[model samples]
Target: MTASTLARRGLGVTVVERSGDTGRTGAALSVPEGLLERITGLRSEQLPRTLAPGVQSWFAVHTALHAAAAADLGIHFRENTRVVEVGQDTDAAWAVTAEGERIHADILVGADGHRSVTRRHVAPDKSDARYAGQVLWIGVAEESAIGSRGWPASVAFQHGAGYTLIGYPLPGADGSTAPGARRLGWALYDSSRDDVLRGSGALVGSVVQHTLTAPEIPEHTFEELARDARRAFSGTWRDAMVDSIRRRAVIGTPVAEYVPDRLVRGRVALVGDAAHVANPMTGRGFAESLLDAESLGAALSSNPGRGDRTRALLHYELDRLDAVREFVRSGR
Candidate 1:
């Protein structure tokens, strides 16, 4: 989003993507209509046709954004580039890739996710997002895999057996909303999974290490989740969860919360999850990330020169810090 916005503002952007693939799993995204247009000032025909509003799969949204950024000549994209170190001086900011290549720019913005390495340079004192003491077991199940007698509810919240399940009727990755083509996306919040998280190293000493993939999930844990699903839900929700569990398609992610005290240092600035990470329960993390990207671009554009780089970045930090802090604290 930052790349698109910056590129549209006539600024050159180099996006260093940590991974080349977009098959990542995430909760459903609330994409407002014309989001890409709003960010890039591009017409509908200029963006990917697969880009649509409403509830979308994470993969779908990413694919569209990738397409949009790639189409812009001002945006240079590097795939599978792991940035190990980020540094900045008065004249320029740069990233040292794992391959030992240093990519320099007038100003560097870190749009990296929760485990952002760029955040370390921006706010070294508070780089890690603290573990929120709960884990979310999330997955998307196809309608054909878990047939329902009627159309599923648009959304549902169920609680039992020390778990809270959030289920949503999601369109297919292809954006199909037909009864047999739609999918069910579910997130099972379980506070009792700290042992599993610690054992899997997904949680370490109050910080999040990583997500637990299906293959890493223990047999006993799967069995327990299956039973818990039965006790907690019925009909479509239960069926979807059981199907995903039987197929071992779920991912367990420990929630992390980060409230930044500062978002910029020298010529380096932080955006998205690198800046703030609110609890997912607020359903405002993604929206806040979008605003961060937009705000950063606007602030920099308002002071578009090397001489005013630090001032622009400080403006972005000051503009966002107050609200995002409230997001994490209040949501928790």
Candidate 2:
């Protein structure tokens, strides 16, 4: 997002990614009207119609942003490049890749992620994002598989027995909202899964290691989730969930939260999960990342050259650090 936003301000960006052609699943995003245009500086007509405002697939939003970044001539991607270390001197910030290539820019933006290497350089004392006390079981169900049922007009919330479920309607992959073409996306927050996480080694002490896919989940765990769905949710939400369970389409993500002690240092800065990780249940992570990019771009929009990079970055930190800290702390 920082890449596209900086590109919007006509700054060249070299994105150092760990992999090429990445994918995500089992999550929904709140895409506000003109969100894509705001993030990418791309015209609405140039974006995919599937990226319209409303609840959207996480994968769809990511793909759209990747496409938008690709379309921008100012943005350059170094796919499959891993940044092992990040540093900055008085003049500039740079990243050292695994292949020994030191990529330097006028200013380096570490939009890396929750497990950010850049974060290590920015806040060494508070480098890791600690695991929150819940695991989110996320899934998407095809309306066609669920048969005839009244479609959800808006987001639904159900809370019972230490469990919270949020279910919302999403357009089909083709952006169709018709009865037969729509989809259901749900996230179930279970606070009683600490043992499973520890046993699977997906959680070490308090840090999250990975998300658990269906293939990795124990059969009894799926059974328990299915049983809980019937007890905790009702009506269409329950039906969609039961179907998803039967199909074993769920993935368990041990939630993590981070309160930033700092978001910037010198010419290097942090954004998104790299800076602060909010509670997933707040549904604010994606939007907050957009805000980070927007604020970063706006902060540096005027400082085109490298004369005052530190001041501009400090301004970005001042703009976001407190707000993002409050957002994360409140979501807890």
Each prediction's RMSD to truth: 1.4, 1.6
Give one digit per residue, the lDDT tens place, for model 2 in 1-332.
Answer: 78888888878888889978566667888887788878866677887967898889988888878888898889888999899999988877899999999998888888888889999999999999999899999998888888656778999888976798898899988788878998899998998989999989889999988888888888999999898889877778888889888999888999999999999988889999899987887777888988999999888975656797788899899999989999999888
Report the C-alpha displacement of residue 275, candidate 1, in angstroms. Answer: 0.6
Question: In candidate 1, where is summed lDDT lowest over 10 consecutive residues?
Answer: 46-55
Q: Model 1, stretches more than 4 Å misplaced?
A: 45-50
lDDT of 2: 0.87
Question: Number of clashes in every candidate structure?
Answer: 0, 0
Tens-digit lDDT string for candidate 1 (37-141): 888787887766456766677888888888878988999999999999999876889999999999999899988888999999988888999998899999889
Q: Which is the leading candidate under lDDT?
A: 2
